[model samples]
Target: MNPFRTQRPARRGGRLLALAAATVAALAPALTAGQAAAAGPAPVPALDVTSYLGTWNQLAAVPAPFNLECARDTQANYTLDPQGNVAVFNRCTTWDGGSNEIRGTARIIDQVSKAQLRVEFPNVPFQEDPAGTPNYIVTALGPDYSWAVVTDPSRLSGFVLSRTPALDDASWDQVRGAIEAAGQSPCVYLTSPTTGGIDTIAPLCTR
Candidate 1:
């Protein structure tokens, strides 16, 4: 009558062990995702700010609440100020056909690489928080300054900027490669509208 008692206990233990292994397997993907999310992107080896100044069209970006008001045609114009700081003027088209513009200042944080910068937009709420610091790293750039990719250390924000409103197939491919290399998921980015001219609504890029 009690001959199967010991076998029952062994079977139960085996089942418990199997369940634990299954649970770990189920959680493996989530663990890997968390690790990837926490790992920051790598910035370009060097950045020449002198050649980086100019108007750039937004090709794609990881959506941010700060830029939520923008519907399409996002762009940024950079110029060197007399004090050696970079003047920033960002503009994007609103849903109502008007444009939203913000003025900001950018200072170099890494003198050697010149790829890291800190940007501040005065009067902007979260963006202007004095206690918080946001990283601006230039992760990629075109040889002739035709396009650039900007990202943060947190990988929460990213932007694909081009000197022109659009890039050719080859250039776009290069931009995608750079985005991936920067630890960003290209699938997560939404293409910015850049048609009917800058600051106007147009067809969106194919994902």
Candidate 2:
């Protein structure tokens, strides 16, 4: 046996290392940690809120740095897919006011609670190699389920998605009241930018 024959194994190890690095590079976007723990448990809304399902227009949200790239009119449409998961179609106007869409799948972490769900975009990447979690809990449902206040414990991301683009004056007050009761500062909410940069602000709920 030649003294340098062992070097052959070393070359193979290098190749394996390169492949592993490549695999990790491809999965960086899908990986997230400490997300599950941040959300805690989904709170039960006081009213029968199930009727709130359907297409919801993003009328307003917190102006966070992460979502700055999303233009006004950013909306999410949730539908049931054949695979028994929630199909999420998120559309937002680009900075230049052009339409952009990201299709994703949402799986309920706990079906019975129907509170927390993981949303993954570009489902194909997940099939190849599921990595970190991108989306996490930010808010919980109100008793009526007519509206929900999603927020992460860190309070970095929050959404006030409703069943319709505009809640009636009475309903609007109820949403604000509920959010306040939950101990969140309502001032953080800003109207979602729409076409032509219109802010459809809702008056604070009186309830």
Candidate 3:
């Protein structure tokens, strides 16, 4: 299950709570960020799919029902298949200390930038793209490709991924800045658990 579906996430503690000077939202809706717009940036112009293919740590994300059972260690791995399509493999650990996974295929829609892609899972039933929406958009990426910010065309979901489980203060700042630059709210995302992970599900926004 992808982490970008519709669902409200609960909070977590530690530095997140300490840094989260803003009060908690008593009830966050399924869609917490700004609606999609034609303006702002996404589909970064210089995404090298070759450099992007590999494992990425799901540091934070918008809560989704499809990921409800996932407790920790959420991540995604991408590989290029013989047909030149990106293979999508997502996995997470369950609360009962189990594991869950789903495999899918992604077709690059933006041939030029290769930042926008339509992903579909086998027997997953999310493929009826009547609206012709792009499911995966690489909105932002670190200069060194150390981190990335991903969301859908509609901005319905958001994810902050990194090469490692935990990010430094500078990287976190960069991630939040990237989200804002992409015309999306960082609050829409909550930290995911990982090895040396944040250990909290708190919103990324402080204000």
Candidate with top TM-score is 3
Error of 1 at 77 (Å): 0.4
**Which residue ranges in model 3 land beyond 4 Å of their true spot?**
1-41, 130-132
Model 1: colliding residue pairs: none
Residue 115 Cα positional deviation in candidate 3, in Å, after optimal superposition: 0.3
- Which digits, one per residue and each the tens of the lDDT, describe model 3 over residues 1-207? 263231233342233433333322532342343443346356889789999999998998776556666667889999999999999889887666767788888888888888988888866655788654678899889877899999886676778888989888888999999888776777767778887968866677742
State the TM-score for model 1.
0.75
When sorted by TM-score, best at the front, the candidate numbers are 3, 1, 2
After superposition on all CA atoms, what RMSD does each candidate show versus the true structure? 17.3, 15.6, 5.3
Query: On TM-score, who's better, 2 or 3?
Result: 3
User: What does candidate 1's lDDT look like per residue over 36-129, in tens digits?
Assistant: 7666666678787888988888887765445555666777889999999899888876555666787878888877788888888665544554
Candidates' lDDT values, in order? 0.67, 0.50, 0.74
Instruction: Quote the lDDT for 42 in model 2.
Output: 41
lDDT of 2 by residue, 127-196 (tens): 3325433243524453445556765434444577765556666665666665554444445455565544
Off by over 4 Å in 2: 1-42, 45-53, 123-145, 194-207
